[model samples]
Target chain A: MDRTAPLPLALLRGTATVLPRAVISAITAALLRGLLKTHPRLLENLTRLEPAIVHVIASDLPYRFAITVGRAPITLTVVDRIATGADAQVSASVATLVDLLEGRIDSDTLFFRRDLRIAGNTAVVVGLRNVLDREELSIANELEALCGPLGGTARRLARALEVIADSAGARLAAMHRTLHPPGTEAQDLTADVRRCHEEIAALTARLGTLESRRKRQADKIA
Target chain B: MSIRYLELVCPAGTPSALRTAVEAGADTVYCGFRDCTNARNYPGLNFDFDELCAGVTYAHARDCKVLVAINTFPRAGDESPWHRAVDHAAAAGVDAVILADLGVLDYATRCHPNLRRHLSVQASAANAPSIQFYRDHFDVRRVVLPRVLSVEAVAELIAETGIETEVFAFGSVGPMSEGRCYLSSYLTGLSPTSEGACAPASHVAYEEIDGRVLSRLGGVTLNCFARGEPAAYPTPCKGRYVTHGQASYLFEEPVGLNAIEILPQLKGAGVTALKIEGRQRSRAYVAEVVTTFRRALDALERCDEGTPTGQLHGNTEGGKETCGAYQKGWR
Candidate 1:
């Protein structure tokens, strides 16, 4: 993970850092259980990745997780550090990791944007990614199921917190833009360049259609 | 209204993706084994023997065919793995075995004479004589055309050779040379030909330095993207390197081949199958690409004229798509 990489989950990261280890353990256990229940082949598929221990680092938080892929029942434990050597390590912000787990954003897209970092045994990491990606997961669904009667309240609270965080992010961006007028102009130019690409694509498609039609007409004439 | 449109052959790296493609209207779903037997041999991706069997049953029940790609060349004196892949795929009752290796093709021809064989693009048989050689030698029922051919060239080759032709409809256009690319091997010591993966994700890394993202393969910097710019894969061919203190892509740019707009031309060019290439992609990608092409093909079957362009740009690499060489728009 890049030290200079800006992590946007400030409110969540602050909250997670202050939390006790016991609470983190409990939440981790429940989330793992939820994943197992939701994805039936989770254990079976992971067991194939024998001897590949995956170290997952939430770069913005104080916690890291070690998931032993080859172990039956799939042991994913939350620890303050990577206690043992790992075959592969994946590092990303808490927000990005959550979005990835819940299938909110595509993994390759994140990889292309350099938002997430993957290292070590290519096969092991790729296997872990594929196994996880095979399932359609949702943190909201897991939260709802993890808590019994308080599930609704938890969901609503989480939703409210997300809204608040987003609003804060937007306002911060606006303020930053107000302070930095040069960036705003650059952003506008980027938008214009994107529009040009779209225009070229549309024109290319139209021309290709006409070419195809002309070829068919040429065949008819022959 | 019995308009026979081209068959939609979709890629599935996993058994789950295979089922998704089948459900999403793929006429045929192609996949490789979990190892280096098939080209998309990425980590944690592809199907095991049992999974392949189940996938075959699932696709067969839905009238969707399954093609096993054992396309990678067998290493000298280490041919058993590739040979067994063909045997297993044949026993698994796959609709066909897509093969490119000459020795493996011969083995399949001699041992499993009943098995159907499709000439993989890895064969790089572009000309009519090359196609005829594969067809006559291995009894190849179809040939996946390389991405470099124009529609006229494709139509001419098909007319001359008279065999089933499959053209890439969407996916990353590997450096124009199909089977002979060793650029990744030069950098990573792992060959896509022998390993079935180009620029394997294991050897790839992305580093952020001074507010720019540097995509590297085998510790060699491939491409650097500015913030807010669409990024490309870290394959050797797409690298932007400096010669005279100015960096630019030498071989090709980082644009994906999108043949959706030119599907009508492809069909008219005597293309038998339209291959959507991305087995290593997630099921979400499989479903989305397959569904989009399915609708377009169905509409084409009904003589509807709307283009299937731009709808797939969301998932395309570099946020940009090209008609590839199908139109040769530059020429």
Candidate 2:
């Protein structure tokens, strides 16, 4: 196993193991409450939806949550394990889930591509998707709101960090390209070999013509 | 100058869109309930009960009529939802109810006799006799003609039936017979007639592979578009498929219908209303389309030959527009 890969994996596992379920559940519930408060349409639409327990699982992470909607004060409870019975169970990578929540990517596109998997009652899932699509949900904004008085400073710092991270990622990609420069070098070698073969063939053809012409002239003189 | 103006019917997916359409000079605005009562049942679309009521009140106050679309077919065993939708639409005090199903139409006629009923395009009542059946049986005030007729055919139908005719002025050029398309259902196991959604959002997806974008519906790749090429809705009819060892658009190309230039012809053909299709679109789209058409209709009323077709080109699907089936040569 690669040492760098294992380090990140071990760190993620450690974090998952160290975090308490109740703490995560409380945090999730609190965040959801804040989201509902800021965007009342989310809750209002949910009230119109049929009562269902929707299990949202982050496939790449050790995170799962079951949300009970279609009632007053919709609740979110983080589950340590997958629920036995769920009206709808939607699973995707953390990045994908974040993209969906942030409205950066459409869920329907992901669902069709098999990047997002939805099992059990499709109607409930459809209803949930419809309700969520109506609102532009941003976890970053939600987190910033949690910062209270320091929200502006926190947002600025976050933006600076993002810029730095993006540049670093681009640099790393460039370095990677330098290390393994795709298949261009191999393609160039093939083209060079083909050119050499064509040159040799052309020279052979010209030499044969010259010898044949000289032989014909010598025969005429004799 | 007694010039008979064609009524400009526009779509409104939300309450805000309804107001936007009306403000942009829609003579009539049509919408549906938030459920599976009407086509264009995408997620985050349509109006709830309160929204519909408010939309009706808002439109009526401005001398604009609001038509409620309860156009989807009622399921065999359960007709309560359909019945309830009709009741709610009537209670909302809409100017009319656009219906397709025979049973639903009969119920509306029997129950709410005073409410005006327009035959939805979903009924596929293209011919005079079919449209006459609806008028005779259900007392349909107007027939929203299917998008399969030519200008001449529409005129002939109007002349023969002597009933009001509404034609699709703009939107997707549906080649298939309305209310009879089972292509989406075949792929996704969801009926468009019953679910009121074709190529439903839940079953539709987009993926990028090798710089090409592939639109899929229910895991079946419908169309693969080159980079920077306009992508269409992943409907089965507009999909490219292998035929005779060549891959090409088998049914129809992804093109939108825009008949702004032909407003005078449609008016001359005795068309009562010109329906602009796109309730699932944004309020901005509603405003632009309604405003452009309003200008065109105003010009027609003045007997002017010029129309603002160039301004409406950007709003078309795939940035390409055609007078589909309106011109005989388009067939």
List of chain A TM-scores, every candidate? 0.66, 0.67
lDDT of each: 0.83, 0.80
The regions of model 1 sitting more than 4 angstroms off are A1-20, A37-40, A50-66, A70-73, A79-99, A102-105, A114-123, A136-222, B1-4, B329-331
Candidate 1 lDDT, B1-331, residue by residue in tens = 1224889999888877888898989999999998887888887788889989999999999888999999999888999999899989999999899999999999999999999999999999999999999999999999999988899999999999999999999998654689899999999999899988899887887666775777789989898889767778788888998989999989888788888888888888888999999888777778788889988898888888675554777677777788878778775
* Alpha-carbon RMSD, each predicted model: 13.0, 9.3
Clash pairs detected, candidate 1: A122-B202, A126-B43, A127-B43, A127-B44
- Residue lDDT tens for model 2, A1-222: 111111122233344456788767666787898889988888988877778898988876566789887787688887756456777788887667766665455454453344666665555676776576556566666656777889668666666666666688799999999998898989999999999999999999999999999999999999
**Cand. 2 TM to true fold:** 0.66
* Residue B321 shift from truth in candidate 2, angstroms: 0.6
Candidate 2: residue B180 Cα off by (Å): 0.7
Model 1: how far residue B2 lies from native, Å: 9.8
Among all windows of 10 consecutive residues in model 1 chain A, the one with the lowest summed lDDT is: A1-10
Clashing pairs in 2: none
lDDT of 1 by residue, A128-207 (tens): 87887766666556656778788777656765777788898899999987897667688999999999999999999999
TM-score of each prediction? 0.80, 0.66
